[model samples]
Target: MRKGRGRRAVLAVLFTAGAVLLLGPGAGAGAGGPGSVRQDGERPSFRLRTHEPHTITPDEGDSIPPLTPAFGNTGPVAAPLGVALRVTVTDARFDTIALDTIPRNCYLAKYHRTLICEFSDAVPAGAAYELAEPLPKVSGDYYAVNGSYTYSVWPLGDPPAHTEDYTAQYERGKDTAVGLKPVAMSTLKGDGESTGDGEDTGDGEGTGDGEAKGGGEAKGGGELRFVSDGYADRADWGIEGIKLRGRIGEYAEASIPEPTGAAQRVRVEVPEGTSFAPLTRQEREGLPSEIDYCTRDAEDGNIYCSNPRWYVTLRVRIDRRVEGAEGRISVAEPGNGDTNPGNNTAPIKLEVEDGPTSIDRWVPPVSGFPVEHDVPLETAGSDDLASPPEPSVISVDGRTGVILLVAGASAVTLALEAFRRIRRARNRGGRRVTP
Candidate 1:
């Protein structure tokens, strides 16, 4: 009888110890349980709010503000150490706006058209996490509605940094969805036929036939002008594993609208320390199959494309990280009725951050990307520096200070602009930014 009692006591003691370790000290002491404490690994409870543009005009292919989502911890017990924000495109008929098309921190989901962007950061209680940059570029016909954007933010095991396993955090987080609304044509002016206010030109001169033609089938015989397609004001470079490298290596192309006459080659000149890398078969699969042949010039280190079909891509490579590397891409021969020769040649200037170190790596080119469908970044002006602006903390709801994380060059620019605008509103008078 005594042995039986001793065995029962031993078992009871072991169970008590196990429970204490799992629940932590003072378990279920106050109104809330020990799970509410950080030491006991409090689970983050949060809320999410989504913000999208009120309306968009298909004719205006220019980037609108991004699909901004905000999040904050709603639970009083525990402050989340870190979290991740994921924005997914729910509906988009055209593949251009798909997530894979987005540049950084984004990839294609299991469902082909679905795009998913995951950004990780430290999110404290009472503070909201948000993203603003690389404004999303969308295009659709008048009265045509694309799909909506769905967003969710959750705590991560290792956040402020990305981790492979974060599924459980999602279950404990929050989510919401917003629709992509295009402006009604009735509000626009003039007939759609005229290239006026009412026209939803997929490009500058499109007829809303679901095509963005520069000088091709849309408007025939205006002028056979050949210009560099998709030229940006500035190209910024980023650091790679402590090395100074092209964050998004420069890419340039000249889109041939239609056959005006016999074909001529396009010339792309590289700086002394840089060279042009041609697209491989896999990379060229999705691109237009119009390139007859491309070869690099031995003497001048220039690239020439002969009989390029719809368009030709020239991916720039930095053979040596030299300072002030500048190059140009242009049509070899001017065509008839080429009125705008100024835009014919686009210059490529590689801008690096303020300080560049000796860490440089040689990355081999497996494939090249087309400009039309690739992710693009832009800023208010070309004169701005490539590096992210200094950090600034803004108080939201007069509670906690929300610190903006610099994700990329474009994000840095847009976030700075957002702050400037907020300050401007306050300075104009006593303007209160509604939380």
Candidate 2:
């Protein structure tokens, strides 16, 4: 009976404490935060796979689901990328889908069809996200919404000696193609009859479309004008290990839009005493298919792609490490082809100020990554640096902290009250009370 009484008292206290803990103000918000970031023990890389666009309507009520974007990351730490998905929703039939007040974390551009949305939280590597959007009432036209997630990465230095701005002009690719002309423009003859387009020999004039001289089919011919196809979120931290000791090697990547359209060159200008170095056997094997075709130009030692392609990802790396060396790698100016000179020539620094002795081995060309889709850290702050995290570092959100404190206090008070009741019962020559 004594044991039964003790058990009853224990159960009552535990239940009361748990209730107090959960009822604390603003609870449950931290349940799915960074604490949930997964560490799958894989090399840090980004693979963004898009699903076939689907349609949602107000008829579906509050059941509009988020997109299951196949965006994965295999990095060291799990932190918010401040990543936003810019979705361009257009009315396929009338071009009148206005961007107005939207749902959770989504904002609209005043005069554009773009809707920018921030997800619930930072996603870990190898995970997928279902992005949210507002549903419309009309069903006359299907919307074609497209966009990409843009984020940044920089060096890891304590009391960071330097923080690179990495402006959009230097990082992102602008007008991909230029000088694209048409072969001929349709024109009309003096007799008021339709004639084939006027021959366009670099002169910008368009003649009317013409039917063949006598009812035969007239084929129109012209040069295809280059246009922007997709968003160039322009950033790849590269896949490789960084060893601090004898030689330090790494990769820098550029995200360009198209493969076959423009003239693009990837130049890796290393610091003095360090030219574009060699890659290991493993590194050579995992290179995207275009390595052989886009090798270093014998004339200038940079990789040039005159006959551009879609498969060759813009991955530039210096394989061999140089002891205690630091410099920046530059993607040389891509001549006339990249009309927007703004993003043509960007430089990235490869700093080894504080050394990492050994880096994790990464065998790239990871299986299951889509051929083209296969694309792709921050330092700690001063206070965090000065006072290192201790073993007993208790990290908790405000709500969680409050809940724990309340629970602890309740448990202590219950225990004291129960003990007093038991003592009074025993002194009165009766069985000790459990309450």
Give Cα-based local distance difference scores for all models: 0.37, 0.33
Q: For model 1, which pairs clash?
A: 290-309
Could you tell me how far off, in angstroms, the CA of residue 44 lies in candidate 1 after the best superposition?
1.9
- What's the C-alpha lDDT at position 305 in model 1? 54
Alpha-carbon RMSD, candidate 1: 27.4
Candidate 1's C-alpha runs over 4 A off are 1-41, 50-53, 58-65, 77-81, 93-104, 110-120, 132-143, 158-435
RMSD of each: 27.4, 24.9
Estimate, for each residue in 1-435, the C-alpha lDDT of model 2 and write its tens digit: 887588667868766666556565434433321222323242232222323323334454322233222233323433344333333333211122332324434444443333333443554543433322222222222121122222111111100112111121111212111111111112211233333432211111223243211001112311111112221222321211222122223344433333222223344444332333344568769876565323454534564432235343334343333345453323332222334444544443344333422344212222221121111112334442232223344445765686687776777677677767767766787656898
Count of steric clashes across candidates, in order: 1, 15
User: Candidate 2: which stretches are off by over 4 Å?
Assistant: 1-18, 22-349, 352-392, 396-423, 426-435
**Candidate 1 whole-model C-alpha lDDT, 0 to 1:** 0.37
Cα lDDT tens digits, model 1, 316-356, are 55433457766665552232234344445655565433222
